[model samples]
Structures are given as C-alpha cells and as structure tokens.
Target: MRVARTLTAGLLAAGALFTVSGAAVADAPAGTKGQNGDPTEAGTSFRTATAVKQDQKATADGTTGDYLYWQFPAGAGQRPTAKATVKLPEASARHGAATWQLDVFDGLRRRQACAEGEQTKRVSQQDATVTLSCTLRAVRPYAERWSNDPLPGAYYIRLTVADGPDQDMGLPVHAEVEATAEDAGGKYAEGGELGAPLHAGAVSEPEDGWNGSWWSDRWLWTVGGAVLGALAAIGGYTLTRRPRRA
Candidate 1:
C-alpha cells in the first residue's frame, strides 16, 4: 500500500509538471522582431517607413513638426494594437510641453480608423514622457467591391510632434514603437515576415502552406496531455485498488 501511494504521488507530480510546461509553451510569443530602422521623409509617405515586429522595440529621434514611421505585419482575423512611447529630455525653455499624435495607416497610406480610444497625448515638462496606444479590429480584404477599406498587410504607424516649442526644433527626442496581435485560430502562417529591403532574417518559406515548427509544437503538447491523462488514470486506479488477502 505504501508503494502504491508513493507511485501515485509521483505520477500526479509528473502530470502537474507537464501541465505547467505546456502552459508556458502556449504563453510564448508567436514571433519576435529581429531588426529595426528609421523612416526617411516620414509623414503620410509610407514608402520610406521602417519595418518592425510585435513586442519588438524600435527607437527614433525627431523634433517638433517632424514625423516618424514604422511598419508591422497584421494577419487576417487578428486584432492588432500598436503603441508609441516618447521620452523627452529634461524640459528647458527651448523644449517645453508638447502634444503628439499617432496615426495608423494601411499599405496604401490611407489612414485607418481606431476601434478604441484616441491615439494622441499631451506631454508636459512635469510629465517628460507620453505614450499613445491604438487598437484595430480584425481587418479583412475587400472582395468584389470598390472600397478604400484597410486590409491585412504591412500596417504603418506614424508619429508626429504636433505641437511643441520652436526652439526645440532639430533637437532629438526619443520614441519607441511596438505592435502586438491576437491569435487568429491558426488561420494565417506563424512567424511574421517583413515586406522587402528590410532584413529581419531569412524569411522561412512555407511548406505546404503551414509552419512546421508550429505544428510540431502542437503535436508535442497533445502527446504530453495524453501521457498526463494516462498517468492520472493509473494513479487513480492504484489509489482505489483493494489490497491482497493476507
């Protein structure tokens, strides 16, 4: 009886461990940003925008009236949230309070509407920093229609110092941008890829239209769950079994 109890406890512990490990794996981000760059001539012109990824930080510097641009991929049926945080140096007479605006644009450079709050903020000498965040609902490509609707593709985030001290012009102010997206039920391929000319890494070519690593991870978790289930059943049986006659 003591041996059975010990075995049961060991099995239960192993099952718990497997469960925790699987959860950790599932919580891991689907992709990572491996490269960063700054925009050229910013503003509404997305042709010179930098490429970035979700949760990946990119830095740029600009002054009042100057705009910075960055782009990230958005898959179909996946909601994406983009955020930009600006940090200004110790405020001086030359650089005082300022209001910043963040705008989201599609591949065509057309502004996309936000599904949540406004993407603008006012930072002052006391604050010295400000962050702008915007969330967009799942975007779908227009089919059999002529609409200027936003589609799933390279999405641009444009940041501009809308109002600030004129003396602060040409002085560098730091800005960090990040983007994240919700899972899309495995509809799109995993591991994001950049558009072109921006080297993040050697983009993986799809094999039979599915990511092998993603499927492998799924298979591993499934096997682990099955093993854990079997161990649980064995442990329960051992705990409930009758003892042999003396």
Candidate 2:
C-alpha cells in the first residue's frame, strides 16, 4: 500500500509539473528585430535585418531621407500585425513636427492593406512622438480567386518620415517596429523559404507544437516517461507477489 501511494504521488507531481511548464511557455513573448538604415536607396532590402524587441530604438536623419525596414516570417492561418513609434526632435517655431508613414509589404513587394490600427501619425511640436500600426488579415496559403493578393512569406515594414525639417538634418529620431502573428485555428500548409534574389534560403516555417518552450516539452516528456515506467513496475510487483498462508 505504501508503494502504491508513492507511485500515485509521483504521477500527480509529474502532471502538475507539466501544467506549470505549459503555462510558462504560452506566456513567453515572440521574437523581434532592431535594424536601422536609409532604405531610400534603390534595391535596398532586408537581407541583414537585426533581431530586436517589440519595442526598439532606430535612427533617422533628414539629410539622408532615412527609412527603416524590417522583415518577419508569417505562416498560413496566421494574421500579422506591425506597429511603430517614431519620435522626432523637439519641435521649434522654425522646424515643425515631423510627419511619419508606415507601410507594410509582402514578399512580392506589393503593398498590403491594413485590417486594423492606424498606419500614419504626425508628431506635432507639442507632442514628442507618434505611433503608426497596421495588421494584415489572414495570409492565405496561395493566391485565390481573381485577386493575386499577397501570399505567406517574408513580410516587410517600411518607416519613413513623410515631412520634416529640411535643414539641420543631423537631428536624430527614434523609431521602433513591432510585429506579431495570431493563430486563426485553421489548417496550415508546409512552410517554405523566400525566393531568389532576396535572402537566398531564409525560410518562414510554421510555429511548431512546442512553440518556443522546447525545454518545457522535453521536461514533460521525461517526467511522463518516468511515471509510466513506475506504474509498470508497480503493476508487475503486484502480479508477482503471492498471498501468505494462514
């Protein structure tokens, strides 16, 4: 009886551990990038975009006509959203606040419509900064119907200062871009890599069953296997034990 109780306790402990680990894994934040550059030049691409947080610091000056670009992977049945905050220098009587614009493009360099959130904001002299965000509803597996709309692949974000001070372009501005995807609970297809001329082999694969908690899954599997082994041992012991004679 004592051995049975011990085995039961072990099983319960293993279950509790799995539950805790699963919760921790689900609450973790998604990946991000921190890239800064003048994307105004021709043929500029996100070949070397840096990994950054949902909120990151970037620089843009007037003279260079600076623009920032970031690329994120999206899978079928997933809806991606991108948000950005642009902080311009203190506004003066001579220098008005800057106007910023945020545009989202698909792997084919086609502009995507925003399903939610504002995509443009102007930072007035009174205000220090402004925010622009956009969401791309369900990225279909392939172009469907008459619309040759965007398909799942590398999504890019472009942030540019639409209007601002022409002189004294040395003033530095802060810009941040955040990207997120929500699962739509629909069937997903096998993921693939971005096509040629871009990042040669950059792939946008579907989120795995493990999400980002590979270690948690490993621990759960380990504990579960141990529980099963213990149960088997207890069963064998019970079957092998003989009843005592009076």
Candidate 3:
C-alpha cells in the first residue's frame, strides 16, 4: 500500500510539473527576453544542474578543472544546441596550454553526439578564452531502446577541462553557456503516413509540434524489418527444397 501511494504521488507530481511547464512555455513567445535577470551560477552534477531556459545566457565562476553543469528543457521536433566559453585566468599565471571540452547529455544522462560545432578545443596559455559548441540531433517523440535516440526532456550541459597544466588546475575561471533549439516541423518519409507510429505514450512537446501526428521513423523501421523477414523466409524455403527429378 505504501509503495502504491508513493508511485501515485510521484506520477501526480510529474504531471503537474509537465502541465505547468507546458503552460508557461505556451504563454511565452519564442525568442522573447526572459522576465527575470540572467542566471549567474551553475551546478556541479546532473541532479543539481542549474535550470536554464532557451537563449538565456548563463554565467558562473569555478576552478579550472571543476565540471560545471547546467540543464535546459527540450521537446520533440526541436534540434537543440549548447554553446559555452571558458575565460581563463591571466595568461601570465599559466604555465602551459590547456584543452577544454563541452558535453551535452539527454535526460537519461546519455552523452549526445554533436552533429556540428567544435565540442573540444586546445588553447595555448596565451589564449584568454576557449570557445566550445555542441549541436545535438533533433529530439523525437519516441524511439526504440536500441536506437538510443534523443527524446524530449531535460538536457544537461557540462563544461570541464579535458587537459591542463598542474598550475591551471585550481585557477579561477568564468564561463558563459547557453542552449537553443530550432523549430523543425515534424517531417515524414514517402511511404510512412503522417503519423504511422502513433505516439502511444505521453511526452513533452515543442511550441510548434504536430502533437496529434507524432509518428514516423518507428513505422519506417517496422516496414523495413517486415521486408527483410519476407526475403529471408523465401531464401530459407528455396534452400530447403530439393530440385524435382524426373
């Protein structure tokens, strides 16, 4: 009984959060300035990741090698990208070159592949700033487990030094980060219907999503598998049959 009640309460809380977030996103026009001042701090891990909205600039101070974490919401049908810059301490205080890296992860904490942009960079000690960017693949409504496709949820951004001189390890640093998404309307393949996959589960959605018709890739793969199975069956039958002898 306790377990059941706990689950129910968790689900209710999740639903409330989703509805409130959706309503807020709906009322706020895209690309509009935020009503509050910009964020000035970031978290150190996924659970504590500071929440940032799309297009908002994030600033934070930390040790050179510390991993800075921030998170932003994403919905289906949007291609999200994360960009960040690390301003190093005075060049004179450095002893050698350093390598910086930026990483983006999905709600599942899975590292996302950057379709474009310099996700890593090597900067000389004389360099004052390191620029990094990661453009992740578009988020989908639902995908097969094996596909490991990105889904709508909170995406986290991590900034850290991949390599640096010992002297730079604890040096003070400032960073700026931001996340953005593009409105790429739901597209379909030639044979697949508008929404053949038929989104059977609940999910977060972008402002301009075809919520009613969220399906495609899933059906395409299903159709492809059926074709392959038919071909294999015919091949197996041909191999098993013996040629008729007169």
Candidate 4:
C-alpha cells in the first residue's frame, strides 16, 4: 500500500513537469574563446584581425588611415557590445573634420546591426579623440541562411576613418577596444541550435565548456519542490496513522 502511494505521487509530479515544460529547449553554450591579455596589435583585415578578451580592454597603436580590426566570441542568449576610442596624433596634424566609423560583423562575415550607440562620428580637426560603440541584437541559437538574425559565433569589430583630411593619413594614433556580452536570458532557446558554433580562421573554443543550457532554472526548482512535498506528505501520513485494532 505504501509503495502504491509513492507511485501515485511520482505520477502526479511527472504530469506537472510535462504540463509546464513546452518542449525540448536549449542554448548554444554560454561564453566563447578569448585572447585574454592576447594582443596589443589590431588586424588590418579579416584575414589578420586580432582577438580581444570579452570583458577587458585591449589597446593598439596605428596610423590615422589604418583599418583596425578586432574579434571576440559570443554565444546564444547574449547581447554583445563593442566600444572603441581613438586618440588622434595632434589637432595640428589634421586638416578638416574627419569621420570615424565602427562596424561589427558575424563569423559568416555578414554585417550585424547595432541596437544602439553612435557607430560613426565626424570629429573636427581640433577634436582630440573619437569614441564609438555598438550594441548587437541578442544572439540566437539558430537561424536560417536566408535570415539575418544574430547567431552564436566569433564577432568582428572594425574601426577606421570613413572620411578624413589627406594630411591625417599617416599620423600615429592610439586605439583602445573592448567587447562585452550580457546574458539576454533564455528566450532564444526555442529557436533550435546550430550544428556547430561558427568559427572563422584560427579561432578555437575557450575554457568554458560547451554544453546544453537549461530552458529555465525555475523549472528545476519547481520540480524539486514538488518532489519534496510528496515525500513529506507520505511521511506525515505514515507517522500520524493510529494503531489498527487486532
């Protein structure tokens, strides 16, 4: 009889779990490969782009007309952001207003749209610095080739002078670039997952292990609570029972 009661309790809990959990949901492993203190030099092209730590700042030196490039890793459910600051050589070296632009691209080399930030800024010759930023849409676990939805992969950052005075072409400049990602939560898990995380060139996985993500941590707590309740109820009934008359 006691065994029967336990089985009944188990069945009830299973039913609740099934009712609440809609489907098999997962996210691309959180986090990605990073260079850490990696490099002080920026790549001039996608072929030579330098890698940067996800949450740390990395600096590089370059000329005014150089196309500086950096790369960082991002995973599903993450909304990654990129920031770059360029310090010009000297106001006297520049001839006129110069336009600086920051661009972001996915592993597939497709440009990703920024949700916020002034990606391009036109600074006067007298201006000392140009700061630009870009906040990308939350990464999705999966997307069709035809669709442009953000997905997990190695994202690239490109900073260059879109328009500037000829005199500024070869002037020395200093640039600091940083990239970070915030947990966008698990809403994108329903999109399904990529066959493999997108990797370009020499990029490789980091220390963070790639594993399936839970649909919601709340579901685990719910299931745990229900099981505990069932066990307590069974124990209480057994202890409170009166001795049966022989």
Candidate 5:
C-alpha cells in the first residue's frame, strides 16, 4: 500500500512537470528567429536612421544625392501607415539621383532586400525642405515588414544602398532619422506609445546542445521517478528484514 502511494505521488509530480514545461514552450514566439527563447517582458523599440548609419554626402558624379537606409527586424516588420520623411541638407547638384531605399534586413542575418524603388530622391522644393516622404506600402514585400516580426530586443539596421550613378559611384551616404519619441500624442515614432528604446534581449536561434528543450524537461521528471522508486524498494527490504522482539 505504501509503495502504491509513493508511485502515485511520483506520477503526480511528473504530470505537474510536464504541465509547466508545456506552458513555457507554448508561450515562446512563433517564427524562425525565436526558437532559442526570450524573456517574458522583452519588446521592440524604434531607432532613427542616423542612429543606425551616419555621414551624409552627395556623390562626385553630380547625378546622385545624399540618402540613408536601414533594415527592419524580421517577423516584426511593419508597413508605414503614413508618410514620413527625414530632413536632408543641401548637397552638390544631383538632378534626380537623390533618393531613399527603405529595405528590410534578412532575418537576424547580415543580408538585406532592396524591395523598394531602385532610384529614389526627394522632390525639388521651393524652400529648404530637409525631409523626404517614405511610403511604406510602396516598397516591395510590404506584407513582410519589420513591424510584423516583433523581436524582443536590440537588432541592427544597415544602410544597404543610396541613390547614385549606375556604376563606380559607391560613395558613402549620410542621413538622420527623425525621432518620434515624446510626441504630442504621448507616443513615440516606433508606433509604441511607451517610447521604449530598442532593447537587446531578442530571442534568436538556439545554440549548441540546447535543442532538446521540451524533451529535456520530460527526461528530468522521468529520472526523478526512477530514483524515488529505487529508494522505496530499499526501505521496504529493510523493514521486512528487521528483527522482532519476543
């Protein structure tokens, strides 16, 4: 009877363990980048284009203009709901080459996709218009944008390309992203009202030896049961062999 009770207790523990393990695994995000696992409170934040890249300049070709670019985090890529622009300074006369390429980065990797206008430039202004409007949906793969990925921490945005001559015109570009933080609506540019800084706890692919996440938890519970069973057996033998007084 005692053995039966102990076995029942072990089974109950195993069940409880499975429940916890399942819950933890289920709570994990769904995507190729989040297999490793991230913390509960981890969230996304927006950074300015200048924050990612700097040093704006016009090309010597006299056909291109200054510009900036950045990649969006995977899965959380967002399409621009409204038109936005960054103020640019006066540079050498580049007739129609001044343009911006709002591209998305390859998932947590160092590759980028130029799924937008190939040659972009700000429209000629009567006054000094430093800003350029960026239409999000106008870019390719609008459905798969950074806002959709929603990683939990800091990721990089790279300057993949700037409008310039067709060839031999790979001059460095410079530009700054307008900060939308602390805006009038009590919200920031990142679309989040909290104005949170891009954090650095995003969950990515799991590293070596950690692939057995769910199974590992199950194994631990099973091993614990075996240990308890062995101990119970030893106790029963000892009690049966005990000497009795007359």
Candidate 6:
C-alpha cells in the first residue's frame, strides 16, 4: 500500500507537469527580444519536422519509453559517407533493444542531396518506476554504397517510435538535426561531376535561431526535475522496502 501510494503520487505529479508544459507550449505567445533586442524563434527552429516519405510517431513513458530523432547534411550527397546522433529525452520509457536506420531521397531542382539519417530504439519491459527522463542519443554512420556517387537533393530525417506502449503519450522530445558531414575532399561535385569549382551559392548560412532567457529557464527546470526524480526513486526504494522480520 505504501509503494502504491508513492507511485500514485509520482504519477499524478508527472501528469500535472506534462499538462502544464503542454499548456505553456500551446498558449505561450511569441517570446520577447533577445540580447540583440530582436524577436527570434527563441530556442526553437523555423524548420518543422515533416514526413517526406512517412510519418514518425513516438511515445514516452516514465523511464522506459522509446525515443525517435533524425538529421541530414548540406552536402549530404557529395560525401562518400554520412552520420548523425539522435538525442532522446530524459525519463524515456524505453529500455532493452534499440536500433537506427538511414534512408535516401531525392528533392527539388534535380539537385544531388542525401536523404535524412534516421535513428530508433526499442526498450524491453522494466519494473523500475521512471520518475525522470534521460537523454537517449544514438550516433549512427553511413557511407554511400557507390563511390563518388552524389546523393539526392533536399534530404530529410525522421524518427519513429517502434516499440513499448505508454499511456498514449506523444513522444515528448527536444531534438535538433543538423548537417555534420565535412567535405571529404577539398573538391566538390557539381552537375554530377567531380573537380568543379565550389560556388558561393552552394554554401550559405542556415536560418538564424532564437536564443533568449525564457527557454533557458525551461531547460533548467527539465534538468532539475530529472535529477530530483532519480534521487527520490533511489531513496524511496531504500526506505519503503518491507522489513524482513527475523
């Protein structure tokens, strides 16, 4: 009965937290100005996730839910290889088995681009109460099957929740996917040919992201919650165990 009560309290608290967070995300208006005193996305990106090929669904339980995230590179097709790291939210309800995959695609302008690099994980059943979340990051690498082969243009990355059902929780995540593949050779491929002069248009800075104080507070709260939950679980288990009568 004691254990049940503790668990119930923890769950209720977590649910309340999630509700509050969702409301904040949905109802919060545009953030104020940054250090530069200009309105920005503020810890969010202009780029929104879309299913170029298929939808990637996700779910997060307390401590063992699976996480899903993906990324793509700028010269994705120009390089012979590619790689990405997917960061999972803390208190992920996923456990046990996990996996990642890479998909290639072609995009607008008949330009050569690599498709999104994908990552996935499948956790087995666990009894431990997941009080807090953890970052579950998966780093996977890929090399073009064909040498000197150019990838398709407009690459995209998507993650899918593949296993472990948790109370119908949308895979809560704070993920960022950016190009990490450096040009293998000083030379670049253009018009499907090698040894072409690199054009300035081929390289340009990505969109400016929002950076402000409010988002920092949100992240700090998330971190603090995870830490407190872990500690509570450890202490609760130690103290609440049945005393073995002699």
Q: For model 5, how does the per-residue alpha-carbon lDDT over 1-246 read when each residue is reduced to its tens digit?
A: 999999999999999999999876654432222233211111121222212101112111111232232322211222221112333334353323344443333334423333333323434422232333232221111223345432322233332235434542443333333211110111111332212313322323221111111232345567998999999999999989969899
User: Where does candidate 5 have its weakest 10-residue lDDT segment?
Assistant: 179-188
Tens-digit lDDT track for model 4 on 39-128? 677777876677765786778889988998888888777788999999987877678898999999998888999999999998998889
Q: Residue 20 in model 5: shift from native, Å?
A: 46
Which lDDT tens digits does candidate 1 get at residues 132-168?
9888865442222366544556688889878877877
Of 3 and 6, the candidate ahead on lDDT is 3
Clashes of 4: 0
Candidate 2, position 81, lDDT: 84
RMSD of 1: 25.2
Ranking by TM-score: 4, 3, 1, 2, 6, 5
lDDT of 2: 0.59
lDDT of each: 0.64, 0.59, 0.76, 0.78, 0.32, 0.33
TM-score per candidate:
0.56, 0.54, 0.64, 0.71, 0.27, 0.31
RMSD of each: 25.2, 25.4, 14.0, 23.3, 28.2, 28.9
lDDT per residue as tens, model 3, 155-218: 8889999998887789999999998887545461223222422221222333444322355556
Best by lDDT: 4
Instruction: Superpose all Cα atoms of candidate 6 onto the true structure and report the RMSD in Å to 1 decimal.
Output: 28.9
The C-alpha stretches of model 2 lying farther than 4 A from their native spots are 1-64, 92-94, 168-170, 185-206, 209-246
How many angstroms is residue 218 displaced in model 3 relative to the true structure, after the best TM-score fit?
Answer: 18
RMSD of 2: 25.4
TM-score of 4: 0.71
Q: Sort by lDDT, best first: what order?
A: 4, 3, 1, 2, 6, 5
Q: Which stretches of candidate 3 lie over 4 Å from their true place?
A: 1-36, 188-246
